[model samples]
Target: MDIKSFIDSTYLKTAAQAGLDENQNQEVLKTFVNEAIQEGFKLIMIRPEMVSLARKIVLDTSAKLLIGTVIDFPSGNSTIETKLNEASQAITEGADELDFVCNYEAFINGEIDLVKSEILKGTQLALANNKIIKWIIEVAALTDQQIIQLSALIKNVVLTHFSEADYNAVFVKSSTGFYKTANNEPNGATIQSIIMMLENASPLPVKAAGGVRTYEDAVAMIQLGVKRIGTSSAKEIVHRRHNQNEY
Candidate 1:
């Protein structure tokens, strides 16, 4: 199934989040970037601060690994200006793709104009820079109806303002893999959520992130029409697929 091509090998934890000192955290990031290169994953998704290092490592190797960084991160409540500035910095530092956390909270609060404006501006900046972009909707934070509406909203914004060719460059991604829910409920991508996104965000691809832990889970997402799967378990999933084939 060429599962490796569908994987966005991800590591977005900060020093304190991972319980490591700054230097040790960076060392871990270096190893993560090297592993993605050796494993031939489609892209390496990291925090914006590490884009320069990842770019340098990829340039040193002959590997075609792409570097992607998040904008506005787990919280999508940042002002539009803040989001744009973060995105611009990431691009200047050599990120091939930018995944922006959509203002899902605003949308949930009925602030449609704010959400729409950010999507329009964010998508515009990304396309103008010739970099692929994805909007993380944080499905776990929304209800079923909100998911459908938000997906359609993003698709509408892109389709209305951008040309047909630019559609592929904009994606409606599922989650950030970092949301905290009450009682530790599943706060990432789920089958039902993905199905809703795929059906409404069509034309604009969907990326299933968070909670995709196994070869079977990844395959399920792909089969359901997702173009990418973001996970920290990329190596384990690939190895599981190989082990299954051997048996």
Candidate 2:
């Protein structure tokens, strides 16, 4: 398959405005997401609150509406119950997919079981509802060893996929832009670490987000066997398309 087809975008208008009220930004997202999907973008990740809106707009058409909000958001400190409840709400509102963040503190603090339970529960939630799950192993906040270990442990995930359990689709995401100025370098090593893990997991897919805001970056990620890319700049990438040039 062509790598470009793997490009999946994550978007939230409230997320776009640093200080806008949730209600106002909801309108902004409605406009932005509706326009983007109408322009032929297939898979899109939206916030949970906007899931019903996004779903109402895209469910009858070819564009696929997938919901992917932060469980603990930029941080991963929220309890598993909170995350699971959020996932349940999203699915109830019509989420076709899920993008969740692992508790970085838990992972760093050696609470490996806690992290696993949350992620595994997310997988189960999505699976039970016939949705696809992509665990955001945010590679940005982790050390090399942590990255390697996280990848290895999560590689055994038995979530939904095209083939067998081994043939998975884990998304090794980068920063959620929670800390754009974070010290963890989102360099080649981050990508390499995720790629390494994806390879180790047979047919798993990596999703490179944060800091990847250009066509070149998207293309590079595609070449790396990434089946779905999470980017907030979908419009920027498709801005020059003659067909999509109107908006």
Candidate 3:
């Protein structure tokens, strides 16, 4: 498979999060965007503030790399209006995709209506702007049953409110690659979780983010039917695949 096309070359950390100054962080982001363009990855997933810069860099090149930004990232507790505002701003700044952290906490807390409403609103906004949307379910924070239920919930929302042509544009992504788990457990996409998501979120598509390292891991996810793999180690994964092919 052309693994590079399945990769969303990602760098979502902020200046504070990466323990670097603003200028230093911008330099890092610039390098990341340049490298992604050079490598011919499908997309560059970045923070909202960097969307304009990334868009500018990509435009300077002939690469068809899509620019994606997270909305209400890591935490999915933002109000529906807040999430929409953030998504709108990202779109205005030239983002081609918006990966919103879904309100899993509210869903687990029995606020089903609230979660459903946000999904509907968020999906609507993205489709209206002709952009792709993915709902990050943050799998590590939930139980197995919760994962299945939540994945199905997102699929239901999209299938019910949107047309079949729009199904490909909406995805049920696995994680934010930012959620913390107790005892340093796997805090990202696991084989089991991906299976659950794929089985339940079919027709809507699934993007396995987080904990997906190594070329083998990426291939495994793709084999199991994940449409995209989100990772900070995209270049390394591609290199590993090349080395394996040479041997």
Candidate 4:
């Protein structure tokens, strides 16, 4: 596949009700998508609120639009019913694909039943609309043991979600980009561990976000078996390789 098709570079804004209220969030997001497309990047990720607007804007363009509604965003504290309801609503709003941040607290606290149910419902909802499901398992909070354990369960989960023949596009994502710094990002080790886990998990793809802000970073994740990178710095990476004089 083309590299463009394999990357979901820009992901969603945190839910406003969830406390991330950037006044310029919408414009920043729109410009990010537009720039990504202009620079030949494909598959711009959009929030639930901006999904329809994204789809509308990119309808005439070749760039593929992907809508990512965080299930239990930032903190995976929402009840299973709320996550399911969110999934259904996002799909109804015209999402080409669904990236769900699976319930992390459940995983950490050994509430595997809760974890499984949320994933099952979300995947089912995503499939009901014929949308692709991308599961985000926040990697930073996990230890090596947890990572491996999650991957083992994800193996079974993916099998249940997609048959061997239908597993072509399943994605196991690394982070949600919740942590940041003044100069850079974090989570390379986390991403690497996730990739290693996925190697054992199944044939499903893996996506690495958070801290992947450069071409070298993108290439490193891709080398480690990440099929995608979810970052807001995609344009900067593209710029590093381009010269204005050449254009």
- Tens digit per residue, CA lDDT, model 4, 9-80: 675555463354565666666676677667676567767777776776677674655555555565666897
Candidates in order, TM-scores: namely: 0.98, 0.82, 0.98, 0.83
Collision count of model 3: 0
Name the best candidate (by lDDT).
Answer: 1
What is the C-alpha lDDT profile of model 1 across 203-230, one tens digit per residue?
9999999999999999999999999999
List, residue by residue over 1-247, the lDDT tens digit for candidate 2.
3333555666644544547777777777778667766656667776677788877777666475444555556666789899888888887887777778778778888998887787677776766677676766666667767777776666654433224643344455555655544465563224576576567544556666666677667776677766677777776676534344466
Cα lDDT for residue 213, model 4?
A: 79
lDDT of candidate 4 at residue 121, scale 0 to 100: 74
lDDT of candidate 1 vs native? Answer: 0.95
Tell me the TM-score of model 4: 0.83
Residue runs of model 1 more than 4 Å from their true location after superposition: none
**Cα lDDT computed for each candidate against the true fold:** 0.95, 0.65, 0.94, 0.68
Clashing pairs in 1: none
RMSD in angstroms, all models?
0.8, 4.0, 0.8, 3.7
Please provide the root mean square deviation of candidate 2 (C-alpha atoms, Å): 4.0
Which 10-residue span in candidate 4 carries the lowest summed lDDT?
A: 180-189
Given candidate 3, what's the lDDT at residue 236?
98
Model 3: per-residue Cα lDDT at residue 100:
97
Candidate 3: pairs in clash: none
